[model samples]
Target: MTHPAVADLIARSNRLGADARNTNYAGGNTSAKATDTDPVTGQDVELLWVKGSGGDLGTLKEAGLAVLRLDRVRALTDVYPGVDREDEMVAAFDYCLHGKGGAAPSIDTAMHGLVDAPHVDHLHPDSGIALATAAEGEALTAECFGDRVVWVPWRRPGFQLGLDIAEIKEQHPQAIGCVLGGHGITAWGDTSEECENNSLEIIRTAEEFIAARTAGEHPFGPVRPGFAALPETERRARAAHLAPVIRGLASTDAPQVGHFTDADVVLDFTAREKLPALAELGTSCPDHFLRTKVKPMVVDLPADAPVEDVVTRLRELHETYRADYAAYYERHATADSPAMRGADPAIVLVPGVGMFSFGKNKQTARVAAEFYINAINVMRGAEAISTYAPIDESEKFRIEYWALEEAKLQRMPKPKALATRVGLVTGGASGIGKAIAERLAAEGACVVVADLNLDAAQEVADGLGGPDVAVAVRADVTDEDDVAALVDAAALAFGGVDLVVNNAGLSISKPLLETTTKDWDLQHDVMARGSFLVAREAARVMVAQDMGGNVVYISSKNSLFAGPNNLAYGSAKADQAHQVRLLAAELGANGIRVNGINPDAVVRGSGIFAGGWGAQRAATYGVPESELGAFYAQRTLLKKEVLPEHVAAAVVALTGPDLTQTTGLHIPVDSGVAAAFLR
Candidate 1:
């Protein structure tokens, strides 16, 4: 059985974490003290449950909370007399864990323990950080909460921080909370509800203050729009010229890089007239240092910059950002500090074009992007009234190099089999294409869901993994322009395309004598011509990237078999098969492999079956449609119905590390079809 107070605390923490506006990603911490009898000694013990490092509070579970013996943690007070206490304090935190092999308590555990309350909420709400990082932060705190809140100067979080918080609490017993300069704000109470309410009240107070200060002000004033206003065709053309170059320069030593264009608050913030000064004001909160560095690197690319010169200009800007970061680190890091890590920019601000976020992989890049968006809004509010005054350079360095964060970095899981790889799946709204998208994403591939139905594609992308792992793009295979933009969208969103699944198709069943030219061309246009356009565009990107890639086409067993009333479908599929082989021959020199899958009897949940074709085929066989799948399953040697997942599995096998040397072959995913077997 769980304690009522602890359960309520967990619920409250989740509520706060669920909103990015309140707590961006995993940047906040919460703690609760509960008394429980130890199962081993049958003695009552005070246990502190705090959000562990790297644990996301939004989806936090009981197991995710770290348990610490309060008395043991309290014993460390005043024990470290030397200047270097971060490493020793971390060791003490480890020794204080009540049970063996649980997650280490958050680095702020000592500070939480020092607060004189059963429930403590420390949050990095943008509103709170906005006010905390402002120039007149202390004066504003006094005005907003009066004597209810105490303002503490910025100290690198460790033993010294805990001691300072304890002294403030002792002196100001009537205050509901205290503000950590350049960090965030913390509120405490006797109950979980009280703690939550206090935090919200404080945030509301800060919001009201900013509102009064910047009554008619805007942070980033208006500026000219660049590629932002271009037509879809031109926008994609610009992205193709810019994204690959940025990815190449960002890669450093890695073979590939991940990137995504963020239109969400990018143009509104980055294109502003005050961007240069506004951007240099520093981070809203020091904790954001983990995801978004101290500040984003701002690159100026005029909207009219020639496509040919964009790459060279981008390269120079990247090097300049790296040099600035190195110098900043050298200026702040002390003699005892660990070796400075690589100075890669986490977020890049383009004045004319929208911002581009980068990471070792797409998911990480998206996380960084989320924080930057939050920062933009927060800083805008702060600058509206008071100039943005964030923590000093020394404080940012301390937080970035804190031992707790370093340990979390070391604990990150090794990349999955398909890490840093990107896959584009056409017709991804349902059936085989959807299955392929899900499978690839599960294996750690960033996916783009392309379909004729824009709404359906968006739904599928959202269900897969939101905009991070998968993005939706509307494309019509027969249109040359749509195909070109589709390829460019994937490349722009995830660095470069590594695997292209040309799986869009529709069947038109008609006898050769009855088939009209329209019917014949529709099937051929979708399967044969669509596959060709996608394959050609993907190969161009893969060749330009100088990295090996896979292009898999979904054909049909009808290509090899003679079937009644399947003239147009069968002929188009046959064309696709030959097209795949030709593509393989041409792209082989560029280290790109092209292959095909011939699937049969995949009736259940298939688009063709759902669109009235299954009943027609069943009526032709003199059986009910419900029995069509089973009847076909019984015809194969294995007596198993071909499933969409099975087809997806075959696609994975070909594109993964196992089939690097084999290409230009059509693998059958159907249970053996005697009529379709090669003669």
Candidate 2:
């Protein structure tokens, strides 16, 4: 049975972790003290439960709580002789575990053990950090919380820090919490509820103080939509021109595949009249160094800058930032420190264009972007109130190089199956295309969602990990220029496209005798020509990169087995299947594989079924439109209707390594269609 206090602590910690404003994805800690029966002593003893390091608080459970005997933890402060005890403390946290079921205790376990209250909570809320790391933070904290909060000077967190906290508690016996200057805040109470409330109260106080102090200032103005140097109509085009350069630079020396995330805020901030002065202010918090790094790399590129100029400037800026970072490390490292990590910048800010955040994979890049966004807000607030003051280079170095902090980075999970690959799916605004895009992203591939409906495509892209993993592009596949641009966009968005899914089509299910030339032309133009255009353009890029690629076409079972009124649709689909085979034959030597998926039914959520043809077919079958899906399911040998996800899975498989030796093939994704089976 779980201890009631530990259970409540997990629930409360989850609530706090769920909100990024209160704590970042895997940052912050919480603890509770409870009495448990000692197995050997047969007596009730004080037990402390603290959140383990690197465990996400939002999904925390009883098993995620590190439990330790209070006496064992308390003894460390007494026996420890000096301050350099990080390695010993880590070992002790694991050795002193009361039970074997939990994770390693957080590095701040000793500090939490010193708090007299039964429940203690530590949070790195942005609002609290904004005030805590300010130049006049000490005075501002005193003004806001008065005697309710005490101030702790910046100290390297470990044994000596815990001792200092214990001494502070003794001096201010009635204090509810204390602010760790240049760090975060800690709150304590007799119960979980009290501790949670105290922490929130401290945050609320900070929020109100910040608002009141900066009421008249407006730091983040709306980003102007167009570039200053380019004509209004060509503003976006110019920005697009720089995308590939930024994406290329980001991928250099990346251990895994790297990509870029774009935003208007980044461009707006970089275009400020005083870019150098504002950007050089350094990170907002010490922990932020892991994401935004010491500072962002700023490049000067006019709105109308040519691609060559943009590339040159970006390369120069990256080199300068790296050189500066190495110097910073040399000035700060001591004899005892580990060698400083890489000097590559995570964020690159381009004037007139937007900001680009880079990572070995999408998620890390997104997190870096999020941190800088918050940093912008906090920096603005600090400057408005007073001067924006954060820890000096020496302090940041200690925290960044700290063994305990470095361990958390080492514990991050390995990348996913398709970690650095990029996938592009046409007609991805809805139906099977959307499913394929989502699935590809889930497998760690950066996806490009191209559709005729630009707005719908953007919406889908925003939902699929935003601009980091997916980008929205409008392409009328039948138009040669549009098709060519779409392929280029995929390369610019995520460095290159390795998976191409040509799935865009319109259905016209009229019988041969009744189908007019107009209807027939539309179906063939979209299904046949569209597929050809996308494939040829995509193949050009793939051949240039010399990297093997996968191309899958979404054909239909109608192509092989004729239906009553599927003449136009089936004929066009048949053309697509043949094109896939030919493309595979021509491109095989270039390390490119092409395949097709033929699916039947799938009446739900598909555009073809939602249109008038499905209603006509349903009426002919003497059934309601909704019943068609069930009818198809029963008609199949497996008694299962093929879903869009089923087709999407096949696409993923074709692009995966399992089919490296196989190509020019057609996979059937329908439940089972005997008539369509290849003999």
Please state the error at residue 368 of candidate 2 in Å.
Answer: 2.1
lDDT (Cα, tens digit) per residue for candidate 2, span 1-679: 7779988999899999888777776667899998989888899999999988667788888777888888888877666757755557767766678867277877788888876779988787777777777889888889889999898888766766667777787789778888887778888888899999998898888878788877653554333343333343354454455554555455454433334444555555655554566678777566576677888888765666676777787779878877898998899887877777677777777666556676767667667777786676566656656667877777777788877666776777887767777788999988899889989999888999999999999999999879777899999998999997897687556656678998998886666689899998899999999999999888766664556688999998887987787788889999998998899899999889999999986787787678776787787577898889888788789999888899999998888767788899999888898999865
Residue pairs whose backbone atoms clash in candidate 1: none
Which predicted model would earn the best TM-score? 1
Instruction: Tell me model 2's lDDT, rounded to 2 decimals.
Output: 0.78
> How would you encode candidate 1's per-residue C-alpha lDDT over 13-131 as one tens digit per residue?
89988977667787778889989888799999998888877778788777778888888888877576554745578777887888762566777787788777898888888778877
- In angstroms, how far off is 26's CA in candidate 2? 2.8
What TM-score, over all chains together, does every model reach?
Answer: 0.85, 0.74
Q: What is the C-alpha lDDT of each candidate?
A: 0.79, 0.78
| Residue-level lDDT for 328 in candidate 1 | 86
Which residue pairs come into collision in candidate 2? none
